[model samples]
Target: MATPNELTAMRRAIAISAQGLGTTSPNPPVGCVILDRDGVPVGEGYHLRKGDHHAEVNALTAAGERAEGGTAVVTLEPCNHHGRTPPCRQALIDAKVSRVLMAVMDPTSRGEGGAVVLEQAGIEIERGVLEQEALLVLGPWLHSLSTGRPHITWAYGVDTDEGHSNQALTELRRRHDLVIRRDGTIEEGVPGGHGADSFRVPLPALGDEPGKALHVLTESGARTVLIEGRSNEAARLLADAVDRVIIDVPGTRPSFSLTGPGAESAVPGGFCLSDVKPSGYRVRLTAERVTQDQ
Candidate 1:
C-alpha cells in the first residue's frame, strides 16, 4: 500500500523529472525524493542530463545520514548498471535505505533491474505507485526506444516575427535534443547555441517524404526533435512525420488563422487539439497528429 505522503513524493519526483526533458535525451529523465521513516521528506533531486549524478545519488547526498531506514520515492526504478556513473541501487543500499517506492520499471536492458538488487539487499520494494503520471515524464524516451525515432514536435506560427518571439517556443528550442531549421533562416547560428544541435534541411520538394532527416537525427541519439519554421515548412512536416504541433497565436484573440502556400493542407490527415494555454501575451495551441486508424 502507498501512503498519501509517498504518493505526494512520487508526484513531486515526476515533476522533477520533467525538468530534464530536452536535455536528458538518450537518457530517461528520473527524479527521487528521500523520506524519513516518519514519512517526512528529507531531500529531493532530479537527473539533469547524461554524465551527471543519478537522482538517487543526489538525493542521498542531500539527505546524508538521515537516509538510513528512510524510504526512497523515485519516478523510475534505480539504475543498476554502470555507465557514466556508478549503479544507483548500490548507493541506496549503502545509504541504508529501508524501503523503495517506484512508479515505473527501467525499460532498457543494459542494467539489471534495480528492484531485484534492492530486494536481495533486504530492502522492501513497492512498484507502480503512480505509474501513469510518471509516464508523462518518460513517454518521449520510451516512444523513441520503441520506434527507433525521436518524438517530433512541430512548432510554428502565422506571424513569423511574433512566433519567433514567443517565450514558450524559445524555451522549447532550448530544451529539445535537436532543432530543425530550414537552410539559411538562422542568422545567429542555432537558437540554442551549444546546448542543442541544429540541422538545416533543404526546403521540401513537392512530394518529398517526411522524416528522412529526422531518422538520421534519431540514429544519432536524438530523442526529442523540434521543428521550428514558418507555415509552409510546418505544413510539409505535418503532411509527413510530425507527431505534435504547437501554433502560437498572437494576442488574446479567441481564434487565429494560418495563411500561406499549403497552409490549408498543413495538418496532414488532421490533428486533435490537446491543449490551448497562455504563453506570455500569446496563446499557444498544442495538437497531436491524427493517424489513419483514429
Candidate 2:
C-alpha cells in the first residue's frame, strides 16, 4: 500500500510526465519527485527529450544531497540499461535512496529489471502506485511501439474555441504529440507554440493524403496525432488512419472511410459511436474503434 503522500506524489509525477508529451517522442514522457528522509518533496522533474537526462536524473540533480536516504517516486520504473544516459537504476542506488515507488513497469526494460537491481542495492521497492493514471500518458507511445503506426484521432468542429464546448478538446491537446489539418495548417498543440516548425522535414503538399503527412510525423517519432479540418476534408485525412472520432454536433454524416457506404472504416476495426452527451448548445459524440478483446 502507498501512503497518502506517496499517492499524491505519484499524481504529481503523472502530471509532470505529461509536460514532455510532444517533445519526448521515441521516448516515453516520464516524471519523478524526490522526497527527503521525512517524506517532504524536495525536488521534481520531467523528461524533456531524448539525449537529455531522464526524469529521475533531473529530479535527483535538483534534490542533491537531500536525495540520499529519501524516496524516489517515479511515474514509470527507472531504466536499468544504459542509453544516451547511464542506467537510472544506478543513479538511484548512487543517491542511496531508502525506497523507490513507481506506477508502471517498463516493458522495454533491458538486462536485469530495475526493480531487481534496486532491491539488490539495499533499496526498498513499491510498484503499481497509480498505474492507470500513468498509463494515460504512456498508452500512445506503447500503442505505436506495438502497432508500428501512430494512433490517430479525428476531431471535428472542436479546433477553435468558440466552435465547441467540450472537455475532450483539452484532453485531446494534452495527449496528442502531433496535430494535422487537411488545409496544410499545423496545430502546435499549444497556442503560440512551435507549430509546424517542430517538424524535422518539409510537410507534404496540400493535395497529398494524410498518409503522406503521417510519414513526416512518424519521422519526428510522434506516436499519436489529433486531426482537425472540415467534414469531407477531415474525412479525407482520416480514411484508413483514424483510431478515434470526436464529433461536436450530432448529425447523419457519411463515414470518413475512402470506401463507400457499408464498407466504411477509419481503420480495420472501424469506429462506432461510443458515447453521446450534451455540450453547451450542441451534442458531443465520441466514436472509437472496437478492439479485438472488446
Candidate 3:
C-alpha cells in the first residue's frame, strides 16, 4: 500500500527508468527517488549505463544529508552483490534511508534478495509497488534471461518505392536496444535523443551454431535486438532465433511474409499474427513466435 505522494514519486521513477532503455543493456534500467522525512521528494536519478553509479547511489548523492531518515523508492530492487560497482544495498544503508520501496525483486538475485540485507540493517522494506508498470520496460531483460538469448524482433516491410520510410520499423528500432541487419551491420544508441545514435550490434551467420551473438548479448549486456531486412535477407539470418515478427505493409502491398524470398526459410513453429493496425501510410502486423503449446 502506497500513499498518494509516494505513488506520484513512483510514477516519476518509472518514467526516468525508461531513459536508460537502449544504453543500460547487460544491466536493467533502474530509477530511484529520495523523499525527505516530510514525504517531499528531495532527489531523483536513473541509471544511465553499465559501470556507472546505480540509481540508489545517484539519488542518495543528490539528496545529500537530506537522505537520512528519508524514504527511497526504486523501480527495481537495489542490488546486493557487487560486480563493476559497489552494492547498492550498502549505499542505501550508508545513507541511512529509513524506508525502501521497490517495484519488483531482481530475478537474478541469489539467495534471499536485497530486501533481506536491508532488513538486517534495520531499514524498513516493501515490494511490488507499481510492478506491472515497471515490467513494461523490464520485460525484455527478463525475457532475455529466461530464453538464454536476446529477445530478438524481426522488423521489415514491403516498400516498392525507394524513398518511403516505414513508420512501424522506425518505432521498433527506437524501442529496441540494438538494430541489426543482414551482412552483419549493427547499430546502437548513444547518450542523445531517442531518434539519433545506434549500436553496431553483430550476430552470427545462419549456420554458425552456438555462435557469438548470444555470448555477446549476454556477456555484453544487451537484452533486446531488432533485425531489419527484406524477406530474402530475413531468410539468410537465423530463422529460429527470432522471438517476434513485425511486418510492415506499405500502401501498395496488402501484406508480407506470405510470398517472399525467405518464405521457404520460415521457422518451424511459424508465427501468430495479432494487432493489425495502421501507422501513417503503412499497416503494421505484429506477430508473436508460435511456440509448441500454442
Q: Estimated TM-score per prediction?
A: 0.81, 0.77, 0.78
Clash totals for all candidate models: 0, 0, 9
Note the Cα lDDT for every prediction shown.
0.75, 0.76, 0.75
Candidate 3 structure quality by residue, lDDT tens digits, 1-294? 788888899889989988887777777889999999999999999987777888898999999999999999999999988777899999999999999999978987755778899999999988999999988788778889888778887766655322125544555666677766544556663423222122334454433543554566544446887777654354344567788876656544556454554422322347877567676776667778887888
If both were scored by TM-score, which would come out higher, candidate 2 or candidate 3? 3
What is the C-alpha lDDT profile of model 1 across 122-197, one tens digit per residue? 9999999899999988977888888788787777775673375645656777666766654313211123222233
lDDT of prediction 1: 0.75
- Residue 83 of candidate 1: its Cα lDDT? 81
Q: Which pairs of residues clash in candidate 1, taking residues 3 or more apart in a chain or in different chains?
A: none
lDDT of model 2, residue 39:
89
Q: Which ten-residue region of model 3 has the weakest summed lDDT?
A: 191-200
- Model 3 lDDT at residue 237: 49
- Evaluated at residue 266, the lDDT of candidate 1 is 34
Model 2 per-residue lDDT tens digits across residues 137-212: 8877787877777777777754332344446566667666666655656554544322233334224543456666
On lDDT, the candidate that comes out on top is 2
What TM-score, to 2 decimals, does candidate 2 have? 0.77
Query: Candidate 2: global Cα-lDDT?
Result: 0.76
Task: Give the runs in model 1 whose Cα sits over 4 Å from its true position.
Answer: 159-164, 182-212, 232-239, 250-268, 291-294
